[model samples]
Every structure is written in structure tokens, then in C-alpha cells.
Target: MKPSTPTRLFLLWMLTAPGCGLLLGLDDFEDAGKSTDTVSDTDGRCHIDEDCPSGLHGQAVCDDGTCEYTCAPGFADCSDSPGCETAITEDPEHCGSCRSPCAAHCVDGVCNAPVDIATSASSASACALMEAGDVWCWGLLPNAEGGSRTVPLPERIELPLPALQVAVGGTVFTGPHGLRAHFCALLADGTVRCWGTNQLGQLGLGDTGPHEGAQIPNVNGIREIAAGTDNTCAINAQNQLYCWGPRSTGLIEGDTTPAAPTLIAESVDQVSVASFHACAVMVDRTLKCWGLDFYGSLGLGAGGPTHATTPTSVGHGSNFAEVSCGLTHTCARSSSGVSCWGNNANGQLGLGSRTNYNSPQSLNLFASQTLRAGASHTAAVIAGDVYLWGSNAFKQMGSNDAFDTLLPVRLSLPSVSRLALGERFSCALTAEGRVLCWGANDHAQLGDGTLVSRATAAPVRWR
Candidate 1:
């Protein structure tokens, strides 16, 4: 039977209704299927939070028809990959954050941990040899204003090559011009580089003009280096020693002109210099000294010549391991123990008396691993313990007493591996790579983030 017109229209509408697949035109059905496929494909792309994949070390979220990734802390997506591939905490090129580079190794997201320290005897500056062969310095350092200023925190000093050792010297000029300090570093390429004041050609750059940055000295093949008041000295791999700068200390014979590096001695194992005197330990384990013999600093016995232009033997007949020269005194470590001589006005000799000794006086201490002498103080490390004596004017001995100590006193501290002394301050490096300082902070040589002096040991601030 044929359907009515009105009934035909109603049947067409019902065929097109949702979930009703009754008879319909082929083109219309094909269009409806295409629309359904488009919706299904869009939903398959990302409809729920779980539909997105998390990137490596990152979190992903489906938002606004797109997937966004968020990197975790200490990680960054520095590449085209879908993961955070860079770990900034351990990366030297991106230490603590992206694009921040470290001159040396990175530690716990921090850069430039110190491995060795150098302090000046007449100036308030100190330098550290970083683990990565870079150098960092603080205290009274040269500023960009063509003068010197105090730096409470460490700042990396630019160098042409990686450093193996560092030394500082020069006296704080009492005049209006600020400090007259200088710095030198033994580069990894067996050359020596220096900077700062060159009033006396201390930088070894041939001229006395002030230098702003690192400059190569007329010296090379250096294994060890030491800086003194207006002078510098170094020992080569061939056991030869060379010195330059002002001839006040007689480091070089002839006129009083500032000289380039000149051979001073041979068969030298180690060398140390001070304001007016210098000393060296020969390969035979004997000690020798030269320069101004103020208060018998030369250790040539009483009534000797006031000064010896050439190296003179310090006869004690003991096998010396190390020797250090102070402003007016000297101390040495040997198989027998530690001994000191020269000026003792402040008991810097570590003896039980204030009387000066024209010869080496035994400290009666045993198994001393290291010893160091400052302007008017002395320090020694025995069995991993630090002992100090002499001047307390700036609390250099780590004591609150106003009087100087006449004997060595142990400091309450962790196991110390090394020590560095300034004009009126001291620092010790712990076996765990930490640094502690005490005494004067007039120019922030203590590096504790303050300008106030301390009578006890304090940890150095890394920031």
C-alpha cells in the first residue's frame, strides 16, 4: 500500500533521528559518519588527564587542547626532547640554574669549592685555589675604580690558564692610597702569572706600572711559588729557585734596582719568604736563610753579620721537612719536632719564654705534621689538631686574652689538614673541605661575611 504525503515526511524525520538507522539516502549517511569520525579523532588526541604522557623528569598536563610539560626542580628541558635532560645541580656549565657556569667543580649546586688557601703576611688579602684550578680572592683587593677596596666575599680572579698554586704579598700602605698588595699563581702550564701592584716590578712584567689583571711573569717551569713584601720567588722542577722584585731583602745581588727573575739557589726542596728574610730547605734536608738579620732572623747564631746577601746555613743538624719565614722570626718542622728562632718579643717562637733565640729552639712537641709562622705568631698541626701561640692583639691565637701566649695551645676544632696565616688573622682547612677562620676582620680576611673580628674559629661563608 502507498503511504500518505504527511506520513512519508514523518518517516523521513524518524530515519534521521539519533540512534535510528532506518532507510536513508547514501550521501546523507556518509556525511553523518564523517562527522562522528571527526569527533572521535579529536577526543582520542587528549580528552582526560591520563590521556597525556609525562615527559622525562617532567610533569605533563592536557590543557586547552594541548599537552604542556613542567620540569622538576634542578632539571631543565634544554633540548628538543620531550624530557628534562639537564641536571643543573650537578652540571658545571649550568650550576644551580641554566646558563650559570662554574669555573671549577660544582658541589651541591654551589660552585668553586676551595682546595688550598694563601694568605699575605703584610697585607689583608687572601686567595684560594679552587678545586677546578681556578683562583678566588677576597679582602683588600683592587677594584674597578682604579683603587683598592675591601671584599667580604670571594670573587673569582680571571686567569689565562688553570692554576696549580697561588700566593699573595705586599704591605698595606699607610698612606691615603689604600693597599699595595699583589698576587701570583703557578699555572698548570708550568708558568707563573701575577697581578695587582707593580711599583717594584713585583708582577714581573718588566715595568713597574700597576697591572689590572693576570700577567705572565718572565718565569716558567715553576713547581712552587711564594710571595713576599714586594717580591716573588719560585722553585722549578730542576730543584732551582728564582726570585724577583725589589732588592731590599738581597734576594738578588748587585744594585738596588728592581730585577727580573734571577737564579737564587739550587737543590732547593721548598722556599718561603717574608718581609725582610727568606729561607729554603735543601734537598739534603738542611735549612738556609738570607736577608736582613734583624733579631737574628738568619739563625746564624748570636753576634753574626747583620745581613747575609747570600743563602746562609741554619745549622741544627736535623733533617728538616719544612721551613716558614715570618716578619722577624722563622719556624721549621723536622723529624725531631718543631723548632723556632729569631724574634720572640711576642713569644712567636712557641717557647716557654719571651727571650729571643739566635738559634733554633725546640718546641718539645712531637709528630708535628705541619707548621706555619705569621707576622708575630706561629701555628702547628699535630695529630690532626691545631695549636697556636704568640700575638693575640687581633685574637690571632684564637684566645680572648689580651696578652700573648708563650706556648702552643690546642684549638677546639675539627680535623685540620692545612693552615694559612695573615698579618693578624688565621685560617684552617678541614679534612672535609671546609674552611674556618679567626682573628682580624678589619678588611674581611676572615671571610665570615662580617667585618668584626673573632676570638674563636668561625666557618667561612660560601655565598
Candidate 2:
């Protein structure tokens, strides 16, 4: 979605956007009422998109200090009563507004993702996120809004559905490995009913067993679940971590194999684990990680032929605000700046050269706030512009050289609000709430429909 010219502004228009906001300066909002230092509720005038800033997307024409989200054709307010939606939903051009629409239901005036929602009948493939206080999912355990709304005994798909995905299309969570797929979880309830590839006891059926259908009768206590190349990690309500699968590094750290949800970390926030390693942030925002460190994917200062058997600190970086783990490397944001360490074979470290580092190295960015690490590549945006480097074999770096970079390489994308990096691909949620993706498309990871890869940035179609 291109930036529409702003039309109005209102000071009394109050809205809150979580973790994402675009503060349009004088030049960006480009409306007629941009004064030097006067912005009162009575100063009604439109100038640009940010004029009547609230959770609404697009530029609003401010009339009497109120901004009306472009109420054009196909753009209708899908906000349920009492549901505080940041943007509009049901727009053919922009569904669910602000990046992704609600996960599934408008129940209770909130968007719920694909999970074991109460309003649902069975497990599904995906569910929309709702601001309301309920949940929903898609697939075929029964049918919430499909064939029927009532199913005797509440039957669901078989367990152990493979290939689970969260934060999909519109923040909906996807479960059920291959078959119709049965799963559970939503605001009211969340149980670990997973499917697919149960080798090495990942299904947590009390054995290194595999189930084609939902495993474990209920998984309500699960608070966080992360899927990796092969292994999976889940943190239960008690702040414990659990893992199952091949190539185990004892991440669960207990006498019993974490074939079930195990406890790990310092009871703070559990960071997402990647293919070979896992890390998390503590109550005070400190970082603790474990698992394989093949090429320094551990992010610990001293990198070598050593790996942590349990969660440990990284290179004296206690204040590590945020961290992202990739296939063989890790990048994190610290008080000072962004730093990376580990395998440089594909330049995933983003240290400027294809040289591997056994220690954390800082990048020479003008001013950086965050970083995201991919399989063997890394992407970061300092200020508002984006930069990527490392592992261009699949052209995930958005450069023509196909050579690994030791420094931060720039990707000329406009301002972005949120960023999510996949195994070998990267995605950015723009300030306009539209998703723009570039880089590798091997598995349609770029979501641009084609097996070809991109050497530069491009807009991905969500339609």
C-alpha cells in the first residue's frame, strides 16, 4: 500500500499501537494543516496519514480533530463492540487492517488466532488473531463456521500433526501436521496438541513415539512453543522448558528427558529457539541460552569447540535487550549496539566480512535498534532503513555479489514496523501494515509464489 496523502488531524484522537508506531514528521504527513507548534483537539485539519493518529491504518482526514480511517469501498470497521482494534478489518485491499487481520473470530469484539479457541469445534490449520477475548482455528476437527457449528463429543483431528506454524498470514496459529490436524489453545485455553514427525519422542506421548493425530489429551499449561528445523521447545505455565527430537543438546536440563514440557530459564520471558539452539530473556531482560554452537550460534563470547549443556550468559551481555537465533549464528541487540558472532561461512554474522568469529563482534551501523538472524544470513534496520548481509547462496541477502559481507549491507526498503525472519527467508511488516518480503523463496518462504530467489527487495502479495 502506497502512502496516501494525509487529509486531517485531531489532538483528542487517542489510540495505542503496541510495539509499532510511525511518527510522521512534518514532511511525511503532508497535509494542509501542519502548523509549527499547535496541535489541539479544536485545531481540526488534515495533512497526512499520521494526522489523527490512532490504531487506524492509512492517512485520515482530520475534521474537527478526528481522523477517519479511509472509509473507502471495501474498507469497513470490523471492530466488535468493546474490541479495541488498531486498524480496520474485512478490507479486500487490507484485511484485518494493520498488517494482519484478526486471526478468526470477532467473538467478544476481539481477534483470536488459530488455536484451541472456545468458539471453535476442532483443530484447524490457522486462526485469525482477534482483539476480543476468544480464539479460533481452521482445518477440520469439526467446524466452527464451516459445515456445522455443533459436533457430538467434540471430536478433533488425529494428533502429532507435522509442520506447525504460528504468526502466519494474519497472526493466526497453525497446527495439525498433515491431516486435517487437531490442536488446541487460545486466550481461555492452550494445550499442546501437536501433529507430524514424532520421531525421537517429540510428540511427548510419554515415549519416543509418534501419533498421526493429536497427542496428549490436553495441553493447557503450555505458555510458549517454538518450532525448529527438527526439534521443538515448549515452556509450560510453570516457566519450565521442554524439548524433543533428534540432535538433543539437553536443553531441558533435567533428570528426565524433556519429551514433555520441561522447566528452563530464569522464569522471565522465553525467547524463541531455532533449528539447533535456544535462548531467552529474563525478568530483567538478561539473555540465557543453550544448545549447539556449531559456528557460535550460542552467542557466547568465547566461541570454539564448546557448547553449553544448560542456559548460560552470552559474552557478558547481561543487558541484551533482544536476540534472534539462526541455523548456525545469532544476532542480538545490546545497550551499546548490535553484535553478532559465530560461523561466517555465509556471512550470517553481519560483521562486514566473510570471516568467522569465535567472539562477539559489533557492526558499524550509523544507529541500530534491533537485529534479526536467518539461517545463515542476518538483517537489521538502523533508524528506518533496512540492512542485510551474509549467506547469499540462496540470495537471501538482497545483493548481487552472492558474496558474504563482513559489514552491514543495506536493503532499500521503506519504513517497517515489525520484522520476522524465517529459516532462510525474511519478512517485514510495514508501517502501513502491509507485509513486504524479499530473499530466498525455496519453499515459497518469500510468499511471492515462485521457486526463484530475489537478489533485491520486493513486495509480497498476501492476496
Please list the C-alpha lDDT of all candidates, in the order they appear: 0.77, 0.49
| Model 2 lDDT on a 0 to 1 scale | 0.49
Q: TM-scores across all candidates?
A: 0.78, 0.59
Over 4 Å off in model 1, which ranges?
1-111, 144-146, 173-178, 214-217
List of clashing residue pairs for candidate 1: none
The sequence of per-residue lDDT tens digits that candidate 1 reaches over residues 173-281 is 4754347778899999999888877766777665676667655655778899998877889999999999888775666776867778888999999999998889999
The candidate scoring highest on lDDT is 1
Query: Number of the top candidate by TM-score?
Result: 1
Q: How does model 2 score by TM-score?
A: 0.59
lDDT per residue for candidate 2 within 1-463, as digits (tens), equals 6443332223223233222232321111111111122123333344443554433223344454444554323233233211122333333322434334442232222333332111110111222222332222222232332121222111223322222323211101233332222233222345555544343444455454445434344345667665554455666666665555444544554455435644455465556566557777665767777877776667665533366777877665566677766666777777777777777887677665677775678876545655666666777777767787777665656665666665676777778645656544566655544455555554344445455667766654333
Query: How many clashes would you count in candidate 1?
Result: 0
Error of 1 at 321 (Å): 0.8
RMSD in Å for all candidates: 14.4, 14.5
Give the lowest summed-lDDT range of ten residues in model 2: 116-125
